[model samples]
Every structure is written in C-alpha cells, then in structure tokens.
Target: MWEALVQPFAEFGFMRRALLGCIAISVGATPVGVFLLLRRMSLTGDAMAHAILPGAAVGYLVAGLSLGAMTIGGLLAGIAVALLSGFVTRVTALREDASLAAFYLISLALGVLIVSTRGSNVDLMHVLFGTVLALNNSALILLCSIASITLLALALLFRPLVLECADPQFLRAVSRLSAVTHFTFLALVVLNLVGGFHALGTLMVVGIMIVPAAAARFWAISIGGLILAAVTIAVAASVCGLLVSYHFGLPSGPAIILAAGLAYGLSLTFGPTGSFAARVHPYRHADA
Candidate 1:
C-alpha cells in the first residue's frame, strides 16, 4: 500500500512537480472560494475562469506556449471582465451577475474562435484542459508565488471580507474600504484562477476553487473553520487525484476534480453541521 502511494512521486520528477503545484493551488484558491460561497457568487468564479481564456489565447497567439505571456494575458483579461462587469452594474440597470454573464459568454466565444483560427485541435485542448504533468520549474514557481500572495491578501482582507459577507450594507456604512475590499478580492480571484489554469485549465480550474469550498460548508460554521476545512479538503483531493491519475492513466485535472466531487458527496451525506443524515436524525439535547 505504502509503495503504491509513495513510488510514483519517489520515481517521477513530473509527478513531484504536479503534486507541489496542485497543493499550492489548493491552499490559495480554497479560501477565496469560501468567501465566494459566502457571498453567493459561486457561479461568478466559473464565469471569471472563462473570462481569462481570451487573454491566455492571445498570449498563446503571440508567444506560443510561453508561460509569462499566457499568465499576463489571462490576468489582464480576467481583470478587464471583472472591472467591466462592476462598471456596468454601477452605471446601468443590469445587475452585476447579468453583466458578468454576458461578458463571459462573449469572452468564451471569442477565445475559442481565436484559438481555432490560429492553432489545431490539440492546441485548443491544451488551452482548455492544461497539462499538469508537464509542469517545469517556471510553472511551479508561478503556482507557489500566486499561492503565497493569495494567502497574504486573504489575511489582510479577512475582517472586512467577513463583514461584507455577513452584511454588505453594514460594511458599507461603517467603512470606506467596502469598494476597495470588493475589487481587491476580485483581483485576487483573478490571480488565483490564472495560476490554476496553468495546472487545471480554464475548464476544470474552477472546480478546485469552488467544489472543496462548497464541501467545507457542510463541515464548518465559522469563517475560519470553513477556510481551514476547505484548504484541507482541497489538498487531500489533489493528492488522491494525482495518485489515481498516475495509476489509472487518467487525466490529472479531472481526476483531482472528481476526487473533490466525491468529497462533496460524502460531506453532503454525513457532515455534522447540516448534512442529509443530520437533517434526518437530529441530535438530542439533554433536558435542562
């Protein structure tokens, strides 16, 4: 059993790189996902994931698989979509969600068209699905760097973010940091999504951000507990997913996400806080 688990990472450098990259993504993206869940913007993460595709595609067109180009392009595209959506919401009758949806749809179509015009089906698949097992030194560095930045940003934004989550009106009334907080958080989301796409691709990257966070909700009531639980679940899913992929010859990105999905199913069924089992069989309190 130990050999089965340990031998792959022990023998393969790419496996080790993939492991480290996925762990870093879990640590950074999961906390942001917790807040996204609290704010009821889970789908927004998916939208933003797609929003970055055009930028990354542009990068690929310009530089042909250069990590620096794709990363920058993705960041720019994500930030543009986020800011544009916010701007539309502030200035027009449409809500932020609607505006964001429109932008992402357009962005997605544009990205796919551009890539197809310039590249082959294989290149399209690489842009859409990523190649985690082929990560080099630069990709690993990018993942680790984004994770560190995300953790620091989350720490600094925690208090206001919690306030924003609990009561946006109250946060706005009490502090001038509401807009600053919201936009900065969106930027962090974009950053992490950019990092994640390098490993999981735009299609699967949102799973790492959102699924583990949704699972953590079943197990944790407090914000800190939710963040902690999410990080833990994401890391475990990454490891298990990598192992399954290595042994079974599966796609690493989907394998990791499927592991996370399994965790979500289990949490929904058996978690202590508000699971299906808990709903059916309430815990009894002793008479006072």
Candidate 2:
C-alpha cells in the first residue's frame, strides 16, 4: 500500500511537477481568496476567471501553446473585465455583481466562439481544464514566482486591505489608498488566476482559489489564522487530488477541486467557527 502510494511521485517527474505547481498556487492564491470571501466577492472572482478565457483563446490562436502569450492574454482580459465592471457599477445603477455577470457571460461566449473557429474540441478542453501533470520547468518557475510575489504583496497591503474589506467607506474616508488597494488586490487576483490557469485552466482555477478559503473560514477566527488555515487546506487538497489522479486516471484539475469541495463540506459540518453541529448544539459546546 505504501509502495502504491509513494511510487507515483517517486517514479514520475510529471507528477512531481504537478504537485509542486499546485502547492505553489495554493500558497499564493488561497490568501487572496480569503480576502475575496471577506469582501463577499466570491462570485466576482468566478466571473473574472471566466473572463480570462477569451484573452487566453486569442493568445492560443496567435501563439499556439506559448505560455507567455497565454499568460499575458489572460491578465489583460481579466483586468479589462475588472475595470469594466467597476466602471459600469460607477456609471450606471446596476450593482457590481450584475455588471460582472453580464460581462463574463459575454466573455465566455466569445472565448468559445474564438476557440471553435480556430481549434478542435481537444484544444478547447485543454484551455478550459488545463494540463497540470505536463508542467514544464518554465511553468514551474512561473508558479513559484507568482507565489512569491503574491505573498509579498499581501504582506505589504495587509492592513489597508483588511480595512478596505471591513469598512470600505471608512477606509476611503481616512485615506486615498482605498482605490489603489482595491485595484492592486484585483491585479493580484488576475496574476494568481493566470498562474493557476497553467495548471487548472480557466474554469477550474476559481475553485482552487475559493474552495480552500471557504473551508478554512469555518476553522479560523483571526485573520492570520484564517490565511494559514486556507493555505494548509489548499495544499493538502492538492496532494490528495494528485494522488487520486495518479491512481485512478482522473482529471487532475477537477480532482484537486473535488478534494477541496470535500473539505468544504466537512468543514461546514464540523469546523470550529460556525459549523452545523455548533449551531445545532450550542448548549453542549458551552457546557464543555
């Protein structure tokens, strides 16, 4: 059993690369996800993930499997969507969510059309679902670099970001940094998503970012603890999903996401924060 468990990573370089990429993504992206959750912008994050597709599709059409091309395309697309959504929200009466939903849907349809016009369904699958186990050295380097940059940026912006999340109006009232903070956070999200798309694709990258963060919320009370819990959950899920994919020939991206979903489910029921059991049996815990 131990041999069966250990042999895959020990024998296959691709599996090792996949593991490292996913772990790097988790470490870098999950904290941003926690902030998204706190800001109640989970849906916005999902929308931005889809918005990345059209740009990536265009990149693929032009450069044909070039990571740099695809990464730049995704970043541009995601930023455009984010900026457009903010603009719409400011200019019109529609809320940010509605604006994002409309734009992202259009983005997704455009991506599909572009991909269909230029590529096969297999190529489309690759763009949407990614090829984690096939990460090259360059991809690994990109993931690790994004992780380092994200952690550093988060560390620098922690206070302002926390204030922005907790009370945006007050943050704005106190300083001009609010808008800068917001945009920087969005850029970080785009960077992480672009990095993630290399491993998990446009569709599934959001899951890697959001699911672990959601699961961790039920287990952590302080902001520091929350970030730690989210990262831990994400990394653990990545390992488990990789193992499942190796052993059973499942899709690595969705397998990793499913592992995170399972953790979310378990946390919802049993975690320390506001879990089902705690809610249902408050008196029992109080006595204990």
- Please list the C-alpha lDDT of all candidates, in the order they appear: 0.94, 0.93
Residues 57-164 of candidate 1: C-alpha lDDT, one tens digit per residue:
999999999999999999999999999999999999999999999999999999999999999998899889889899999999999999999999889988998888
* Model 2: residue 241 alpha-carbon error in angstroms: 0.5
Error of 2 at 139 (Å): 0.7
Cα lDDT tens digits, model 2, 1-288, are: 887778998999999999999999999999999999999999878899999999999999999988998999999999999999999999999998899899999999999899999999988998999999999999999999999999999999999999999988999999999999999999999999999998999889999999999999899999999999999999999999999998899999999999999999999999977999778886775676
What TM-score goes with each of the models? 0.98, 0.97
- TM-score, candidate number 1: 0.98
Identify the candidate with maximal lDDT. Answer: 1
lDDT at residue 133 of model 2 (Cα atoms): 92
